[model samples]
Target: MPSGGESMLESDNGTLGWLNFFHKGIGYFAYTMHRISGIVILLYLYLHFFVLSNLLRGGVAFNDLITSFTYGPYDIFIVMDILLSLVIFYHGANGVRLMLNEAGYGLKHHKLMFFILESGAMILMLLFLYYAWQVLLSGGGV
Candidate 1:
């Protein structure tokens, strides 16, 4: 039978193999981030849809639902809300860029493409930070 140390090493080997697969090249980085952003946006959409569904139940129900989501945990909500927006925007914009490329209209200059992608990501991040700051300053508890 394998020793305890041998089994542990085997498990770790498997884990490292998975990590190595993801670290292969720049393509993996883009694919990983794209997937993560998709998940985040999906979660946000669920939350937003749930909130809007309350509207169908009447104004009072919607108000109560909003209050429950935003009050008491104002700081946490603000942070999540800001992040949700950024995730959605980045995922959407990146998806469009990727689609264009797939359709044979991609950027010929690799450096310029990456630069624009990074710039767009940074702009979105800054916008979220700015909103978070606004909330904090206004005593929204963010």
Candidate 2:
């Protein structure tokens, strides 16, 4: 059998090393998702502001830009929007859980709190998506 140092070196080597870092537990999973969602939301905020800036040009320019999102290859944008909404919801819910833990609340029930927060986020995301889908399919044009 390999020595401890040799085993550590082996696990540090390639794809397995990366995969080994995630999903070890609820805390680990939540930490990873929180970081990822935070980054995604930050990037979306930048893009959102940039797009909104187009409105400064004129009503016609703004209308044309918005109109471009309604059909064709831009249909993928709808899926992305839904994903962004879910990420935002997850990030917000997880942030609250983390805040409570830091504040000396729910420390003993950390795992349970993680589960409850994640479930609540999912339920909220589903409800939002249901309404979003209705708006999308009703020819509401986002």
Candidate 3:
């Protein structure tokens, strides 16, 4: 629409440039996910403090929380744990990819590099999912 051969990322109105950034490449998407997953992991760390603080209240309180987590219908937490594994994997793989890029590697083959890193993350996520499901089915559930 620009008639001068600008990419789709450059909107005719110019105000939507941010919206088009995701289409730039896998690297950008991976970058965004990295930031998001880091935030999520940070938030989870805070939640750990909250949960573990129960120990100070009393051992029984802490034990109850642990019991609730490992028993009953709390399967959702395990599912979340599996999802968190995925986020962790993606965050790590993307971090490595970014490091290699900063070290002057994979600049020319960025897309391929992105695919390889993300594929490895997916595989690792699936492996974790399998192990987590086994735990869930083992009646040790958690």
Backbone clashes counted, model 2: 0
The candidate 1 region of ten consecutive residues with least summed lDDT is: 1-10
Q: Is candidate 1 or candidate 3 better by lDDT?
A: 3
TM-score for candidate 1, please give it.
0.61
Task: Identify the candidate with maximal lDDT.
Answer: 2
How close is every model to the real structure, measured as TM-score?
0.61, 0.77, 0.72
lDDT score, residue 26, model 3?
A: 59
Better of 2 and 3 by lDDT: 2
The deviation in Å at residue 132 for candidate 1 is: 8.7
Q: Write the per-residue lDDT of candidate 1 for residues 1-142, one digit (tens) a residue.
A: 1111112123233433423425444443444455678877777789789778888999887766666656644446766777676776666666665665556554454335545776787687887788766765675453
Ordering by lDDT: 2, 3, 1
Q: What do the candidate models score in CA lDDT, each in turn?
A: 0.58, 0.71, 0.67
Look at candidate 1 and give me any clashing residue pairs.
none
Tell how far residue 19 is off in model 1, in angstroms.
8.2
Over 59-85, each residue of candidate 2 has an lDDT whose tens digit, in order, gives 998877765675544567777888899
Off by over 4 Å in 1: 1-22, 128-142
